[model samples]
Target: MLAYLADVFSALSELNHSLQGRELNIVTASEKLAAFKEKLVLWIKRVKRGNLVNFPCLEETVTENSTLPPTFVAKIVEHMQMLCTSFDGYFSCGELQTCNIWILNPFMQNLEDVDDDGSIKEDLIDMRHNCGIQMEFTNSQLDHFLASQREAYPALATKGLEVLVPFATTYLCEQGFSCLLHIKTKSRNRLNSEHDMRVALSTKTLRFDAIMEKKQQ
Candidate 1:
């Protein structure tokens, strides 16, 4: 049972890392989450048949003479089912399902299957044919692609933006909290937190050498 839990935690850690990225958008997150839930369903079925392939340590410890207790296997299956349910309850949204259709890669999707009016379908067809648009879509992130298309394809861009703009995880929020903890220490409690936070959270690097040269002049 311990080995089983350890394996489960390992998988969860990977999933958590995958979800925690600056560029993670709803489209990508929904895909990862759906894949994870499918894996859980598979694991539940395998576990019932005494398949310990996923849990290597458990498999190693068990011999042909040894049998897995029915109650223990039942508990493990129940736990996995609960995890699947929790994930479905949290990430299951109609908008997420809709975005899963084509925003990730419009070129790979069938135009007829996309749940949009004729304009979006036209935009997709245009995007598929245009060499420059195809190159941009291939090189840029989904959010960037949608943003760049706003002028050329207003309706498509708007729909994509509705899915892309929302944060997929609480990573940024947690990062801000951690930054605040570092910035607003007891010694610096009375200091101006706003400016300090702005500097700390900024992705831009300050050029100290340039600043020094200007100061000397």
Candidate 2:
């Protein structure tokens, strides 16, 4: 989950960079950035609303589940929290543009430290000015941005968004192996190479079958 959130935040940062690259005037760029931020905030709100009602105590329940260790559940919860907090930071498109302006206009005699929470006062001054008509993205251009974001994760590039399934499944497999080790230690019989080989092969076959079924669908 940490990896997933990292990927998402990284993608958003990349998207911001792309948006800043447009040759539009400051006012036009600011408007586009504001629109993007609004969309992101709406997405976050939708996620929170659904999660609050459907799984109000999901984290606590998962933590208490005996089949899975608390540490693993804690990690998941930590990642979820990171996602929530980071989204709030990223949703401030105006602040993001202000930071970009500081970098591009180094010749400006004075600059103030504009942290994430700072008002985008610099851009607001030119809010009514026309920066000329902004160019719109073609379908191909949009596709390129999406492709670049997904390329950050190889699984996402290959299997698309369903990449999370395999990632989570792999983690679960590690926990299963740990439990198997505990069980083996309790048994009197020593580790049998042949038996272990057969068990591993069966597990691999099952996983492969599942992957194939998903692909077929």
Candidate 3:
């Protein structure tokens, strides 16, 4: 479903040639999103009827027991609304013109302005207004700016860049879950200890020769 939506977003071009390389603007996105969601809702119902897909982790294979019910489908449909609400502010922050202004909302409400320590500094705040607008208004652009100007901005570069990068999916999370499954299969139900499990699951290899040379030294 995610891959399908991604393709649709990539293919759907604005009539104006000026937006040829850019992502879909809000108004265009709304129309496309509504159409996509309508089709998606119907497709989801069909999948439920077809009984092809499986729950991510569970061992259950029975269609009658595993397939999502109608109420659950309706709940899933509300996710589009939730997504739109979430993106409304973040999208505003995507533009250089509005990005800093939206970020510095005094209530600490804008996601980019939010600091966990509640000790956001004046220098960092000044950097936002001073530098954020001059840069290109894209996640990749900001990432490149930090990569190039680490000495110039220091910690503020990291702080500002962190919030701009969006989380599209749990790709790493799903990979880690699959790794856990591979490590703890039916054959090996449990490890002796958490430390043992960590050692077993780690991708690193032993450097016995290096350790021996250090010991000799």
> Residue by residue across 1-217, what tens digits does model 2's lDDT show?
4433554566567655554422323334445656655655554454444332222344334334343345654554555556556755754434334443432232241345433443333332232132320121122343232244343333222322221112311334554576566546646357654565455535344566777888994
- Index of the highest-TM-score prediction: 1
Q: Which of 1 and 2 is ahead in lDDT? A: 1
C-alpha lDDT of residue 61 in model 3? 37
Candidate 3 matches the true fold with a TM-score of 0.30
Q: How well is each residue in 118-198 modelled by candidate 3, as lDDT tens digits? A: 334544555457645345334344446544545665565555455444442344355557667777778778644456556
On TM-score, the stronger of 2 and 3 is: 3
lDDT of each: 0.84, 0.42, 0.46
For model 3, the stretches where C-alpha displacement exceeds 4 angstroms are 1-97, 100-148, 192-217
Which consecutive 10 residues in model 1 have the weakest lDDT in total?
92-101
TM-scores of the models, in the given order? 0.87, 0.24, 0.30
Worst 10 residues of 2 by lDDT: 128-137
Backbone-clash count (model 2)? 0
**Candidate 2 Cα errors over 4 Å, as ranges:** 50-217
* Clash number by candidate, in order: 0, 0, 0
Q: CA shift at 97, candidate 2, in angstroms? A: 18
